[model samples]
Target: MIRPKWTPVAWLADRMAVLVLGLIAGFLVGLSFAGDGRILPAATTVASTDGPAPSPVPPAPPVAAQGVDGPIPPQVTARMRRGGVLRVGVFGDSFGNGIWDALYRQLPTSDGYEVLKFAKEATGFTRYRTLDLEKRAYEQLARDPVDAVVISFGANDAQAVYDDGHLYPLMGDGWKRVIGQRVDRFVAAARSTGAVVYWVGLPVIRDPQLDADMQAMDGFYEAHMRRLGVPFVDSRPLTLGADGKYTAYLPDSKTGRPVLMRTGDGLHMIGIGYQRLTSGVAADLRRYAARVRQAAGRPAPTPTGEPR
Candidate 1:
């Protein structure tokens, strides 16, 4: 075999060839990276084995559990699962405002209950211009979601009612139907947010005419509550004296003497009166919360942070 003689030109050509090969290798390696120099992971798309994948199964809604108070609201149970407070939103007139404080005091914050005040003074089904109950229910719920709702309305609604270009004069001329529809709408909006609603009826007043009007309103609420299957808290019965009539004073449980329950104006009640007024509701709430915790597989919280 004849061997070629080694020369400067041959050596230079060999070096050039090595340089060209190296440059080509570097160019191929650079192409593997993105323009930003990030190494992209290899990916492959597999063709569908069936006619487009079946729509992803939506999560099942929370099931309602039957409890002593009533059917457990899905929202309430969900909140319990998240270890959140059981929120109670009160909406209506000044009565709602009063009862909110009473309820707040009854249901302690440390016990995992939150009472939100959405009540406004001088606002009712008759007074839509001041505050629209149905609209506000949706808006407020959207802003601060809640699990339970308590609505106290009626005292401020015994006056003139105007709806859809028509004026209703004091509990007459389609007043009951229209106002009942308004109540239904507000409740529907509230229930849409998965909150359980409670309707509070009118209490007995001092004035004869006002008391009669309140009784009539209470009748209306009772009829509607039956139809809607909502709880009707007949405050009149709760506020009645031993004589089975409206009374501003009741025998104090501890003192065994008459205590003034009504305010001087006779339009509202005192703090202790409110406490008594909201006792049933507070008990109902506690029971509902207990049910929620039970359904979520959690135990009741005791003082020592241990389950009861």
Candidate 2:
């Protein structure tokens, strides 16, 4: 890669690119939808001290006030498993990828669930020009045909944004408006397909500024989801310690020894960490599956076409 001179204007331009690319990868590896899958939201706020004693093995998703705002829409619940099996498509950035991994296992195929990954692509509302999530959503759902959607993004979104050829600070009104519109459109596209959509809020971060930005991102998404009647999943409590603070290492469920839950980059998590972080998402998916079975009055989920 050719290095650009760090002149004032060049440095500013480079930072702009960083925001669009999530500040991690050298190139954009957008999430694939309308063809393949993945989804996302953003987060931050980390505590330096060793967090308090670990909470229960898997904390229940937050009640409406904290973790969630409303229940899954009834219309979606009614038709989610129309063909017997419920097909769920997950989307977002790296965290979305982890959540998909956990959900795929939590809601196994034998139980009449097919969890397709939508996170393979590195895309989000911030990457509006790199990929069109809303359009891909329609195309992807039409091809893969899922009855439910799960999305977690914004981890790499605490940066700048673009609108009408103008650059906007991460938290600027223009950025929020653009990102919110993007969130609404992408989610609406998913809902239009009659799928129950859930937006997983940003998880705890180890950085102060980033975490604050992510908190704002969470509120933005939660408000949008609530407005559209899509269920919103809060991720903070799932990762926060008993004292309601961020901790990168939590005691292992079995050994009770502190285990690293976050990556060196302060963005990603290991399998064990993902297990802790995604517990709520896994729960929500299972609950929906059970509802489908009960509503169908079936002994077992016939879940469409033998669990893809």
Reference-based TM-score of each model: 0.73, 0.70
Predicted structure 2, TM vs. truth: 0.70
How many collisions per candidate? 0, 28
lDDT of 2: 0.63
Residue 177 CA displacement from its true place in model 2, Å: 1.4
lDDT by residue (tens digit), candidate 2, 74-169? 554555546566788988887777767667666777777788987743567777788877887788887876767888888767766665656666
In angstroms, the error of model 2 at 14 is 8.4
lDDT of each: 0.67, 0.63
Score residue 276 of candidate 2 by CA lDDT.
60
What RMSD does each model have against the real structure?
32.8, 11.9
